[model samples]
Target: MTVPAAIQSTFDDLGTPLADVTFVVLDLETTGGSATECQITEVGAVKVRGGQQLGEFQTLVNPGEPIPAFISVLTGITNPMVATAPHIGSVMPAFLEFIGDAVLVAHNARFDITFLKVNCERLQLPWPGNVVLDTVHLARQLVTRDEAPNHKLSSLARVFSTRVTPDHRALHDAQATVDVLHGLIERVGNLGVHTLEELRSYTSRITPDQRRKRFLADSLPSAPGVYVFKDEHGEPLYIGTSIDIKRRVRNYFTASEQRTRMAEMVRLATSVTPIVCHTTLEAQVRELRLIAEHKPRYNRRSRHPERAMWLKLTAEVFPRLSIVRTVRDDGATYAGPFTSRSVAEQAVAAVHEVVPLRQCTGRLSSKGTGSACVLAEMGRCGAPCDGRQSPDDYAEIARRVARALDGDGHQVIDALGDRLRALAADQRFEDAAVVRDRMLALVRAAARAQRLTPLATSPEIIAAARTPAGGWEFTCVRYGRFAGATVCPPRSDPRGFIAALRESAEHVERPEAPVPAATHEETEKILRWMEQPGVRIVDIDGVWVCPVGGAAGAQESLDDTMTDRGDAVDFDDSTISRRRPGLRAI
Candidate 1:
């Protein structure tokens, strides 16, 4: 059995949520201080899953040496008690088998784990390489210093109301730790920490400034909305959104929100203002808009809508597709607000490969003619400027371009599909991947454009999504932008409630002509919500339907493009302390 360098296990990968993970909570009663000076006297462990005890292991180990009088008094494990007990060499292998492959947890885990590792080495026994967790650190993170007084097992046991109490004994201490671990896990759940990798890397070291700003979120609404953290002079420092605005804002002061720069921003934050919304969709839209408008220094994403490039057909007698930074009201066929200019270009190039459109960037007049470019010379373009093609002939070519870029984008998809196949057949997987990515971006953008293209003059629509909490969330969208939104409590007749919600909802106005990338993104978000199976439509002043064959394959392409995920979490040291500086074990 050859263990090649790259042929390793993938189970260590980062995102196994806490609830799904098995935990082995263990405790050791040792003879003395360090592993070099001490010997294990007893071992106790409880195997747990989702807060339920699956099994337990308990054993007494003979040190094969005299037990000190103080140790005998502390543990109540005298020479007579351990004289009949098996030695550690025999007990160690049994303990290892009992733990299995689950994550190992214990209070002050380093002290206990160190002894086990050293003993395993001396006994020539294989150690189960399980990731370790210290409940003392977990207590420090979940319980405030004043609440616990100290992160000792005893203090945590009292604070969390442990099922059992520790009294210088192995099994009792292990039982207490099991309860503490379960409680801390539930606390971290509120901070969006559902994954085991997240728990392992969790850090709660908020700067003094973040601690002081805790008062700012005290008055924030618990309902859905956007939140802005402002500086002393009233400048926006950071912006965020949540269904529970107060909970989301408060999480910034906890260990789970450990983005280093975020702590610094919170330190400078003077106030927090929440924009309460009727639904999660509205909250998301408002958050994107505020981040774009404020361009907060502390905010990294959703700030620059203008930077998103779109490949749009020009509104002219001789229309040629051009990559533009702005999405405007001018009547033109558009392909994408692609992630980058290169991607937009790839989409445009993909279009040219199938539908021959004029490749010249110049704005040509109906009457004037210019020298033909290389593409026209190569017969790849219509060559309207060279008089090789008449106005009507070029107009026909432009119409093909419009239909290909606008409708279901069958031509564009087919073109990219052909190129991808050619590249893959040639063993150019990298090239094929590039084409696949272009196709994905094209599909996403075309999906957006197709939704708006046919219904450019579509009427207003009111729809509702059944929230997870049994409430109903409603949205009013007109011409692809949100007009109004509302959330209603659970009701017997959803239609009547939605109608009333639509009537009283505050109108979320939008500019009619020019649309920003943020607006497009928000519109797509609303459409996605409306398309969900359980969501119901209450009213329609106009029309809103998934365009035939539009974005139908977009979801599939998204799945294909994002199929590969990064491997599980790896840490530099066994202790979470070394994983993050300024963070200490309890």
Candidate 2:
């Protein structure tokens, strides 16, 4: 079967060819070996691609300190020689611009890269997250010890009979390292290491087992989607998502895939299944759903959103807070879907500190008599179990706790603040820190709930975010569930597309209050995407508002170090409509 020209082009261009990749072979001279306490004296680099030298950058940097006598004698770069040279701070930006996102190659790369990184941090400049290649490691992998006694640049320079000789000087060493790099590439080229990705990940050649499974990626499409790797029995071994399904699956069979478990999975795999989607968000959501459903052995994350813990106020006459695994429609106030029981317990402790609620585990009926625990004796509990506090009186205390959990956490914040202050005044700083942590945990949980509740209750919300390619990515959300996602190209009318979307979108059932339409993690993912910078709410139904004086205010203060309160409720989706009047209606 003949593949179409467009499809064939995508398949052919799986990765950047090694010949096309620009490499900056760099060398640095520093005052000392330790990057932390040293200063760079000189920098040199040679940029090349397709075995042709593009440019060379060499600079003598003023060390701002006296060069050691032995070092000055070694490289001949004296303190007097660098006295008029540019400082490292003045030279770094230009050097960074010179490298320009190219892969960095060096002999003993860690030593050279470390000095550059430490200096970049000292100058408060952003270090480019570049892919660094160590010729030492490469030579050790490719060059046999029989050919050279040691895998040093000088040794390899002789092994390859390079044009440039390695001296102690920076530029000469960098040039020599560049030639060594070409020699290693030539050696690996016969082993089918053709791409930059393969070269970067090439420790040795891909194992024969992994090489055998390369055909698994052949039939997959080059588009945004999820791919499943299944074993001989057809059960899923691993599941993953990517924008380019074919290219990403192909990576699993290459030297770039370093994970041991994945290498094993690929060896045991029988077939690859692809589920294509229209947008990246849809692909992500589908991946999460598939992983949760199949619980693939090789997949580690997003498989158990059900394991999340929540703090629920029990629906009883004498209500008490209980940590729960799931949210239900029990008419009880809920605080979190916290990541762990310990964190949920912290939020529980924060609540107990603020409210005088019963603490006993035994179910206490209004008519039954149960003994008061030690907590009541310490005045921490209402002791309703012993009839010291009436059900009516205990109900009032429960109301205050419920109010705090339902986003009005002003009372909880104030009480914790007073306790925190009292502990600090008494010089019990450790105890004060404990109080501060508990308060922050509770506030963070409450603040998260407040943010999600509006989305949960809303009937339908149409949102769009501008893509980098002058298009817009639209998401249809209903009751906090990601119902559908689509992209509108630049200069196109989104109203008709949105109208079609609303008609064809999945109909999600409105969940009971406090129980989000989707799992807490999934809803939070949607919320995060919705909150990104360029997102605009195109249309919405139902009241989407947060409490004015909610836990959001407390969360803000906690984030800003127990001071500076900001309004927690910024639920104004109308602002987006007012700004983008053209994309307002469906």
Candidate 3:
């Protein structure tokens, strides 16, 4: 191919680096559309130096599979034509050698790059280190033709009045791309965009690494979760969480303009880590727990203990629920360590409707001689003070009230439904109707609060894998729209995947339970109970204890001075350490 006079003079006038620089314009003809399924049938490159063609390289690659009929028609490359051709495995080394130390220029760069990358990955070849310049992106920036409809190679050829022969052939396409690049350099030069770096900036290929890093960073989870970064020291430098952990962490790493901060962090860091949770509810709980434990220097937000409001219920005989402001501590029967008083009140109200417990000011007398309180008059309370209800009956009611307060909606629904059915069977229609309404309301509320997803049903635990560009890409079925995405990581390791799976399963298995009111002594006992198998720490006998394990082991463990209330005995660091190693650090 010969350089036209007008284009040659324009290239010379532009004084761009291309004339003196070694450039390899390349193209590929593949057997099919999908990069994963298809194989490249032809590889071609045209080497240009000092605005003159130095040499051209072209080879037919045996695709190792049958070329699809449609592909054959599109590129005029038959299976038989490539039958005796050199395979990619045999041709790649020479190709790499020829294009050594030269900028790679291509049309629709990603398409060519995808095929190239796939080929390199398959052959276990390290992709050559060369700057990529996309002529398509360059033309888009240089050409100001508003009516040009498309920027296809054919359209670009027409715009530049350049001859494009043997359209789809690899060498022909490479030559065409070279002409397009020359035209863009001329046009951009006219606009005073003459520098090589300046021209390179117009196309995305100039900063592939930066773009890849930014892209992967953006795809990270924008939800409240944990993130960890480890240094070459093999020690963790940062352990933090965010309402949007992925975004927060990505912001730290991808702040390109803030080179000092990012460079320092990246230099100190060798690996990125993340732990995704099912809900923001769990995220907040986990974040607080991790921050208090790890004390990572970068975690400024969650380092401090959060102040929480609690409902203590102080006035009743069985147990009085009092509304109080406090940090999470081991003392009293606390309903919440709620983020806000309003939220605590809302939870209390929800519990109250299902389990009719007294919310009154009057105290219960030992003689049981007090007059009926206002709540008793309204039938909202069982008047235990006046002996209208037995202690055992009131105790049972308190248990129901406690369960409602615990926010175990599934249990509440079943219990309420049974009660409603019993009332209806007894011909108490009005009472049944009220109970039925309450049951329905609770069901609706639970449904709304639940995290229901198809992925949730899978036996395998799911973690939002971070992409190389820093974003979370996952399958989402929204209404009727379904999207399946391939989220590329900056790097991949089998061991990392295995470790992530194990961690995810552990998290899903051990979701945080809502903490209840308990004295310091009771909390210690509860902690002890949790160490036992199949023994969960729950609120029991107006205290937080392992209801199952405590009852089973309490008699055996208790000394003569220690009461059932868990108040007299104190637990030592050794005991706490044995129960929870993580807690011992705190």
Q: Residue 25 CA error for candidate 1 (Å)?
A: 13
Q: What tens digits encode model 1's per-residue C-alpha lDDT throughout 523-580?
A: 6566566656666666666544444655545534444445444321221110111111
lDDT of each: 0.73, 0.83, 0.55
Candidate 3, residues 1-586, lDDT tens digits: the string is 9986763333322335645678899999998778888889999899987668888999999999998898889899998999999999998888888898888888998888888888888999999878888988777765667836678888888787665653899999898877878888787666545455445654422232332343334345555567776667656566765767755664553322354544455556656667786433344445556665666665554454334455554424555555566523343333434434554554455445556576655567645687777877877677777888777787777655454333343445555657767888999999875554444333322221121111122223222333335533222111111111122255554345434434433222211223322222222232332234432211111122123321112223322223454543331111232222111100
After superposition, the stretches of candidate 2 with alpha carbons farther than 4 Å from their true spots are 1-134, 144-147, 157-183, 195-197, 205-219, 250-260, 562-586
**Which wins on lDDT, candidate 1 or candidate 2?**
2
Could you arrange the candidates by TM-score from highest to lowest? 2, 1, 3
Tens digits of lDDT, candidate 2, 265-330: 888999999999988888888888889899999998878888888888888998888999878888
User: Which of the two, 1 or 3, has more TM-score?
Assistant: 1
lDDT of 3: 0.55
Q: Mind sharing the TM-score for model 2? A: 0.73
User: How close is each model in CA RMSD to the real structure?
Assistant: 15.3, 8.0, 18.2
